[model samples]
Target chain A: MFGLETGFGEFFTNYQYPVMIIIGLTLIYLGIAKKMEPLLLVPIGLGVILVNLPWPGEGLMAYEVLNSSTGLLETIPYQDYVQPPYNMAGGEPVGLMSRIFHYGLSWEIMPPLIFLGLGALTDFGPVIANPKTLLLGAGAQFGVYFAMIVAFGLGAAGLGWFDFQMGEAASIGIIGGADGPTTIFVTNRLAPTILGATAVAAYSYMALVPIIQPPIIKLFTSKKQRQIYMKPQLRAVSNREKIIFPLMATIIIILLVPASAPLVGSFMLGNLLLVSGVTDRLSITAGGGFMNVLTILLGVAVGAQMSGFIFLQQKTLGIFALGLVAFMAATAFGVILAQIMNLFSKTKINPMIGAAGVSAVPMASRVVQRMGQKENPRNFLLMHAMGPNIAGVIGTAVAAGVFISMIG
Target chain B: MAEEIIEAPMVGKIIEVMAKVGEKIAEGDVVCTLESMKMENPLVSPIDGTVKEIKVAAGDTVQAGAEIAVIE
Candidate 1:
């Protein structure tokens, strides 16, 4: 009686749900077969499937009402649950992913925690040894600004593609960062509605970094520039220098960009644990258990945001299209700027390394290494590429801080 | 005189040992290199001395402040 009405009857009303389920299956297929960030895509794909299933409005993935004063999650009244604008804020969550998103993501705790783990795992020595790579990282952020301006312009022109507000533009722009945690953090704050599309786009593009970066790198650099060799030996950093670097960087960067304090603070704390050498247990925990748990929660929450009605939009398609351009633009800008730097500097760097400045971590750097080796077997650019690769991570966080400072 | 021991400066794997037992080395010489988070950190001698013992070998994981070598 109640079951068929909720299942078959409800399914007939919105044909989009079935289609979304197919899309979810496609994500699962791609994750399993293509190995495209399976850790994230698998959970996200399952989340999509779970949320899209036909159920009563107050069922599992739907927003259940909460009493603010009593601090209890309550069932939403049938009328309110079925009405438009189902996402009422300022309530405790009953659903698992909702609670995770509300407490972890909305409160801005999970992303920084993820960054802490990343910091604990990251090697900053390459960036320290080659300071100039920081500029390449900064240059790669041109795509973020470029994408924002373009998004805002399209919205202003009323082109039917999208009409993004300032916050929405900022959220969309961060897809260029190619850093998943930072993108989600920024989107959660700026435009929660588009969080699913933006996160999916960001992660999807990040997974495709090897596919996305090489063409842009080739477009920007000549074969000679790609094959240019720089010595791989890095000056050994001392323990004192390593210990001092994170502290100094956090202090100086936060002073300059106060808004980045949360992200940079957590990141530096993780780095401190690693470099201080006195906190092996804490470092291992941060890098291993903590990161894994947070990644799962974050992935599921992001996928849960892809509820059928929210994700099936022309604007969603636009976000995906623009995301690709943003990633390519970031990669191109980094390579082109590296070529420009070569004109003024005595020691020329392999321009292939510049494409690694997109914060996709070792993937972007590995692409550079592979491409370099393909050109010349003697070339080992992984460490060299890592400098800019790691620099891109910091640069993206700094950009997010700047955006939050100006727009939030 | 106080006995001296070279301690690991950070948590990492001992990738290479730069000093050998019974070898005389000056202050600031690298005793061993530790690889952590994909970057190499060099453990240095605080005082000039002959290496008395090598406490850790290549491929061994070490904790920060753990004794890696002894010099006297």
Candidate 2:
């Protein structure tokens, strides 16, 4: 019998494999035990582990190369693969995860599809009821540009510590929007190489919105500001208004930023399906099973991209640091804007609702609700915060469109 | 006594009903927890009163403006 040798020795040869595996396991634990973004994190964690594991044959992310001499296909590590149109003819992507990443992300199919699902699930009533909240959402985008300037400045300073191009800076800056799909959409277009880092940072920070947003909300606003209460009920929005919102928004946004058509169009289409009261079946599927499948594919593909060699780098650290700065700055700007708005408005607005402008959806709004409750139990700011919460989505999508138009 | 009806703030599932019929509750007291958009939102009482009627039970799906409970 032939002696079968286990590939255990590969761990010693490449220490990064073990380190990456541990990181993968930590993400899994956080997802399952802590219940933190389990839908995305679980698949991402598993993908990381799968790609980093020792394999005697071609790896999960291996690229296929056609060997002319032997007239056969040969597999090479993804990092070693060269861009197409320059490399030898007949070469193709062969790995399962690699193909998904290429088709779903590189071809720019997943993000828009994900937005469709999100749109079906979202209710634009809050934003329609309170139009001024749109400005608050726009205010949160200050962090995106602020971080971009800092990142560009650092890179231009000639400091060897960091080097980022305009596209890369834009990709990193979108992390401030606190919208996961937007970050992925922007990064996949602007800097595919940093997609894994930016996606992970965006999702992780989004999950940590409850923790990340409060300090900044409290730091800028005093107890009195935090306790400022608005009317408990907003003027009831009619279905007619709800139906008109998506159509008008799509037309207006697409006109302003043509590049945003894909993201905005898909989002509005989903919203139309939900509100039209005529596409129940399509709405259910878009927001349900279809979205789930896309999410799994997206999560795993993103995770597979985080190979030890690509993810374990000095640049990855810089991306994470810049992402944090983006989130903090976005929160601060939102709060400051609300405070400024109060100077002119008659009805008082809880400054904390401005923090929800980062578009973490219900999470950021929930943080505002909790902090509002802490300040005064009588304050029910969830619905009010939701105004800006939903607006953040549109705001981020517009910011992404601007980036793509200017730099993409 | 004036009757005050608590309405579901948003569309969601009634995860848990914390208030009982005829139970004395204070204004702002959480009467039930509504799970909407994957977030647990507590439906609080609008005025200090006794719970006159519980209109919905746990696991019931609700729509925005649906009456949740009637307090007197």
- Measured against the true two-chain complex, the DockQ scores of the candidates, in the order shown, are 0.03, 0.34
Could you give candidate 2's per-residue lDDT for residues A1-408 as a string of tens digits? Answer: 287766678866988788999999999999999999999999999988888876632277777885555666678656555443224334476788888888898888999999999999998988999999999999999989999888888888865546888888998889999999999999989888789899999999999998999999999999999888766677788999999999999999999999999899999999999999999999999999999999999999999888887788888999999999999999999999999999999887998999999989889998998888778776778889999989989999999999999998
Report the lDDT tens digits of candidate 2 across residue range B1-72.
899998876678999999999899999899999887777778788799999999999999998778999999
Every model's TM-score: 0.81, 0.90
Q: Which prediction has the highest DockQ against the true structure?
A: 2
| Candidate closest to the true structure, highest TM-score | 2
Residue pairs clashing in model 1 are none
Task: Give Cα-based local distance difference scores for all models.
Answer: 0.82, 0.88
What's model 1's TM-score? 0.81
Candidate 1 residues B1-72, lDDT tens each?
Answer: 556887664467999998999999887687887775465556667677888999999999996557999888
Docking band of candidate 1: incorrect
**What 10-residue stretch in candidate 1 chain A is worst by lDDT?**
A77-86
What stretches of model 1 exceed 4 Å from their correct place?
A2-6, A56-58, A64-87, B1-72
DockQ, prediction 2: 0.34
- For candidate 1, write residues A1-408 as lDDT tens digits: 654454666766787678878888989998999999999999888877767766643244545765555666666522243234443665446666667777888899999999999999888888888899988888889988888888888888887777788888888888998999999988988888888899999999999998888888998888888888666466676888888889998999899999888898889899999989999899999999999999899887787778777788799988998888888888988888898899999999998888888999988987887788667544557778888888898889998999998898
